[model samples]
Target: MPEITYLEGIRLGLQRLMRERPEVVLYGEDVGAFGGAFKVTLGLQEEFGKDRVFDTPISESAILGSAVGMATQGLRPVVELQFVDFGMTAVHHLLNNAATTHYRTGIPVPMTVRAPCGGGFGGGPFHSEELESLFCLMPGLKVVYPAFPSDARGLIYSSVMDPNPVVFLENKYLYRHVKEIVPQSFEPVPLGAARVCRAGRDAVVLTYGAMVHEALRAAEQLASDGGYEVMVVDLRTLKPYDADTVLTAVAATNRVLIAHEGWRTNGFGAELSALVADRAFHLLDAPVRRVAAPDVPVPFAPELENAYRPNADKIATALLELMEY
Candidate 1:
């Protein structure tokens, strides 16, 4: 119906959920009157009031612990960590408690932890970490990272309504950098589904979050520069990732390049590589390649940060290498 930024899409989804569901309550650091660090939650407190949309203390553990308790009860708590990097402090609550509640007992922890992640701005190490792999490691947690505004809006609705714990990763870079016209009324985008953003036959780029955009750009560049048609598959959900779609893409395009903004070692792309190697190795024309940030902290300097993050150039280079292989 209208063009909206990625940040606005998430806000609209949250607003609609609060309006429709009485049990959904949102709280986080300075998320109330002060809005959020990125202002994604701006004006929400005024609309929902303090009880439903309030602020919490400066403890990630306390915030997550309370959410886990509230979720086990009847309430669906949507908590926000100012940055995904801060979520490391409360991993115990997620890994040990929230993730184990249903197995330990019969209770479901329907909680959504909205984490702003990735590096493009000079947010230094603390603010720009991509920790999707960490959340994916948790057995009971579902990880959703949307690259487009429409997907961001729809996934937020589904994540909130889910019975299990969900880690909703909002790439800080995409918050304003990406925008698209989406219908005002939309359906929830099903989790564990991957979208083929671009179609090709020579090579395929498997990525998620901000890297999805980078992969698309790389695909475009390759099509014009080297007459290579590169496919780009966006793994919208990491935990219950769409294996069938991934294998299909790999089968169609005999070469694969897995890209992400996280570290090269043990990142989410590593899992995708393993999946291809394990299930679709016979279908590949080249070894699975990956383009990711080095195993180093996100830098504060703009130049270093730019180099630290994977971009279209990096992905295209890797794609060319895969094509030649």
Candidate 2:
């Protein structure tokens, strides 16, 4: 086993998908010889050729519209957006066309949109936005966000294989910041599953993506600082999230705290909070809390970005409030 970063894991998965499935194709802006804005697709064009792996123009709407067409014609097209924030320009293709294709025309749109999201390095507003909730609200799109390298590798395979539109969000900050030793090969992680990364009885933090790692750090800090054991649940898939696992964690812990890097108002955390309130209202020992970015654009200055982003310290403080409540 070799230790690989989160970005490498995604690339490995893309490589495997292209090699195993000849019908699979990858294209995006600057994704060819340029290797993508973050170099996640470096050397893929040479190995897979310009036909299967190539670059496209700056028009996201045109890129996604073509992908929807390709998917209907029996091609698995993986399109990447330089940043998830830019996706708003062409969301109608995803919402009206790709999402409603199957129900309207009985044709499956098996296209995967790879989007780099989140902010920790001062990408400002245009480059650093967490819009998972916006995608999740669409009826026909499946949203997947991986917190670990192993999960990133496995989920990409599953996302590409699924016979529907999938939004695969990659946390930009975690590309090189997180690493793990994974097997040379592994099984595909099923969509809509949640993993309990840490066990505890006091409280549980419901989160995903980069926040999962922060929740783990907060759990450790709480364990040492207050002798409080905090549980952390990573909701790997957002749309068809693992409700059973979440309810179970809430039942066992009796306290819940939702953490995310997105805006607190109407963010994905609100959905999770609603789920707990609806089904497991009686199981709570305290009011469900949230630690998320305030409702504002992501700041450009490093200091401002640091305050704008939800971190381990914020999570820890929220956990303490939940525990004390």
All candidates: TM-score = 0.99, 0.99
Clashing pairs in 2: none
Tens-digit lDDT string for candidate 2 (1-325): 9999999999999999999999999999999988999999999999999999888889999999999999999999999999999889999999999999999999999999999999998789899999999999999999999999999999999999999999999999999999999999889999999999999999999999999999999999999999998999999999799999999999999999999999999999999999999999999989999999999989999999998999999999889888888
Off by over 4 Å in 2: none
Candidate 2: worst-modelled 10 consecutive residues by lDDT: 316-325
RMSD of every candidate to native, in Å, equals: 0.7, 0.6
* C-alpha lDDT score of every prediction, in listed order: 0.94, 0.95
Task: Record all residue pairs in model 1 with backbone atoms less than 3 Å apart, i.e. clashing.
Answer: none
lDDT of 2 at 181: 98
